[model samples]
Target chain A: MTYRDAINAALAEELERDERVFLLGEDVGLFGGAMAVTKGLYERFGERRVQDMPISESAIVGGTLGAVLTGLRPVAEIMFIDFVGVCMDQIVNQIAKVRYMLGGQVEVPLVIRTQGGGGKSYAAQHSQSLEAWFMHTPGLKVVIPSTPADAKGLLKSAIRDNNPVLFIEHKLLYNEKGEVPEGEHLVPLGQARVVREGSGLTIATYSRMVGLVQQAAEGLAAEGTEVEIVDLRTLTPLDEETMFASVRKTGRFLAVEEGHLTAGVGAELVARVTKNCFDYLDGPPERVAAQDRPIPCAPALEKATLPQVEDILTAARALVG
Target chain B: MPDMTVPPLPPETMRALLQGMMRVRAFEEAVHDLYQRKLLPGMSPHLSAGQEAVAAGVCLQLRPDDYMVTTHRGHGHSLLKGMDAQRMMAELCSKETGYCHGRGGTMHIASPEVGCLGANGIVGAGLPIAVGAGLSIQYRGTDQVCVAFFGDGASNQGTFHESVNLATARKLPVVFVCENNIYALSTNFARTGATPNVVDRARGYDIPGVTVDGMAVEGVYAATTTALERARSGQGPTLIEAKTYRYYGHGASDHRPYRTKEEEAQWRCSDAIQCYGDLLIERGVATAAERDDLSARAAAEAQAAVDFAVSSPDPDPARVGDYVFA
Candidate 1:
């Protein structure tokens, strides 16, 4: 099945399971969502459940937070993750802190689903990836899926989670094909999967970068350099054990992402691995991230600005002692 | 949903509502005097001097299970909604036994047991939360309703517009009680916008909206009961704009520099105590002696609350994280 269809399956399955689960965003209802992830939800689940909201980004987050705290689980879609700044207070302060502020008397089981990454050349405002902003908060859970199966499984888990989760999607990975299991199953948060096993070196990534890591692993293996690949589906309760185990096995690590280098999730992972497995490391961990600049609208500029398969290969080979 | 029927409530009901208003006015007066003596500390207490009717009337209609989300200028609302006066006062003093363990202080008082969601220091932030509470009531199929009491200043915030639209659209059971006390900190209503009446803004949401006499607790009581009945019956939301005023400065820190002395005097002349006493007599509800006795008793009650607050033990600073995450 396609990655977009699996997301659709998760939405349909969630709506079928709980009467309180609903969607609210611009063009979510009749238009079937901007990426068509919620295409049939509007027609099947009706407007109330798979809802359509105004272009008010701040209110959308606020309203979803309100809904989640009161009793319902509201999954709000911000057309693009770049516009998250519009609702920073609702996302950062209100939603994330409600559970903690009330002294844990309340729970905010909310999900903000938005498309991120800059491969589409959508330009400045529409193309920036800001997952790090959410990662900076204490009470938030950030999830990104590279395959359809992971999308469905992680979304199912996010729906049932009692904390506020930022369910991020990549613009380029939605249509990719992958094997998805049928029926209800959840991918637990803080669990990392070994997308491919190797022994010479380790490469860890998540979201769209998973494909790049896989390609880089294949190319490295052909050159007699075995690479252990790990996909950390969740960033918050990070699977530092799986990462550290893989790093200790290979004695070398390389982190990758589509976000900027300086404080990206990749940097955090590398810093933690370096600190935790300092003696086991064969070489210092290196991060290959997007250039720290606005994503230009031109296809060539956007392509060069983001980390590609060649960049991943180059960074991984450099990590080899 | 039940229809808005203006019922002639029991005579004691009006007396009860009026008494609540008097309690608020008297408490604020005491706080004002205490401020002059430099006793109160922390956030500037925004007195509910002329705006007592809204809280007293609306709280009178709420069931014990219903919830109320108050604003920064929320002493009247929190007190009238059954929050213990001693705890509230202690909180204002940042005492250990305060309503929020001193973290909330005046603007952030919260009581889960009494269904008072934390009073917000930020404007326009509580409306959506109240809507969420109402949604919970509806989703769980409970009889509870949530009332959000905001001010004229909060009415201009974006959350007000979004929450109101969402509430009316979903037909949620909630009340948007606005105390239109003429001023937003330092700016008056005329200085803000052309829509002089706050209720006029409610029409855009298509909810039943009204403006009532802020002086008469019965007027507010009657309106609040109608709105509550509509909400409890699953009808929808209502906007009640109580055109009241505050006699004291915005906070204990204010020197009354923005407004004139004559303006303050005009509003102070209609002190809720004097007006309610006159109303009870005019309606033949109570004798002059009884009213006098009630007034004295209320003063003593206020005194006891103040004593309890002053004598209450401070909280241990070590266990600050208690009840944070269960």
Candidate 2:
């Protein structure tokens, strides 16, 4: 099924399963969500739960926090994650701090579902892999799902998770088709997966970059080098066990992130692995990431600035060969 | 204004009101003392020393099920809303025994059990939060009404307008109590609002707004009871402004330049805790000795809270990720 259809199925199934789950955001109601992820929810659920809110990010995020506190799982669509900056206080200050500050008295079981990544030609304002920004915050669960199955599974898990989860989907990968389970299934947080196993080297990635890693792995395998690709599905509850396990087995590591390299998710993974599995490394942990700058508008410049499949192949080759 | 019909309250209710005001006053005084000794870390404690009556008045009238979302100057509201003094003190001291377990410090304290959503540090922030609660009530088809407590400065925030207008339009079961303490942080109400009274601005939203003598517990209780009744009946929201004051600076850091000491001393004479106790005495609801006993009891309880907080254990660091996920 198409990734968009899977997301729609997840929302529909969850809505039917739990009365506490509701949807709100800009153009979420009658407009069917900006990304068409919530296509026909309004016709079924009506306007009460599938609420259309004013373009006030503060009110939307703050209201979501309040709703969850009062016993509801609210999935708010921000249209794009880059716009989340406007509601930083609501996200980092309120949502992230609620459980900790309240001494575990309350849990904001809320999900902010937004699409992000630089390949859409949506330019600087719309395109950005700011998962690193959310990943930096300990309380928040940052999920970037690349495939149709993961998009649905991750979102379902996010809705059920008590912490405030920032569920990011790649804008360009919406139409991509992949096999997904017909019924309900959940992928647990703080876990990583070996999407493609190989002994030559390990290519660690997530979200859109997982697909690039697959392409890079396939390209390198033809060159008589085997590349293992690992997908870090959930960034915050980072599965260090699986990461270190794979790295130790392969003894070579390459972290590829679509985000800027400066203090990116790559840096976090590098730091964590260094502390946990330093002895297992064959070479210094290599990061194939976007240039440390805001994404530019031109197509060629954008391609050059982002973490491409060739970059991952080059890093993978350097480590194993 | 006397046309306001009086509902007969329980005989013990007056005593309860006096007890609540005294408790808040004693509790705030302890917080002030604790601040002076540097016992509190990362706290901007906004004492409701003189403004104790508003919280006592409105919260005493509410059932334990009714919710309250308050502002930075929220210690009085929290205590009056039934938060244990010990937990509030622990919260102020940033201990694990606190309502927020050392993480919230003061601004972000919440007790879901008592229905005290929190005492927010940001101005005008609690209105939308309360509005969201009101929406939950309506969605669940319950009669629960949420009370949003804010100061005069918060009335000018964008949230105040958006929330009030939305609450009125939807006829949500919520009460907006604007404690018009004459100042916002240190800025006077007249400096920001052009409306003769902040309550008058609510007329534009088509909800009833009333300005009351905030120092009198009975007056505020009487006014809040009517508004709350109207809310529960789905008559819509009410914005009540209690003209009150704090005897101290906005945070603990103000150097007393914004207003004259005479103004502070003037408000101190009509202290809600003292005046309410006197009212109960004159009405024969309580004896002078009983009032003194009650005040002493409150003081003792506030001190006991400090002791409890000091004795509470530090949270285990491993559980830092506990509540972060369900």
Task: Report, for every candidate in turn, its global Cα lDDT versus the true structure.
Answer: 0.81, 0.84
Q: What residue pairs are clashing in model 2?
A: none
lDDT (10s digit) by residue, model 2, range A20-138: 88888889999998988898999999888788877777777777887777888888889888999877777887788778777789878999988899886777888898998888786
For each of the candidates, the C-alpha root-mean-square deviation to the true structure, in angstroms, is 3.7, 2.7
Off by over 4 Å in 2: A317-321, B1-12, B192-197, B200-206, B278-287, B310-324
* Backbone clash count for every predicted candidate, in the order shown: 2, 0
User: Model 1 has how many clashing residue pairs?
Assistant: 2
Candidate 1 scores a C-alpha RMSD against the true structure in Å of 3.7
For residues A258-316, could you state the per-residue lDDT of candidate 1 as single tens digits? 89998998889888999999999987899989998888899999888989999988888
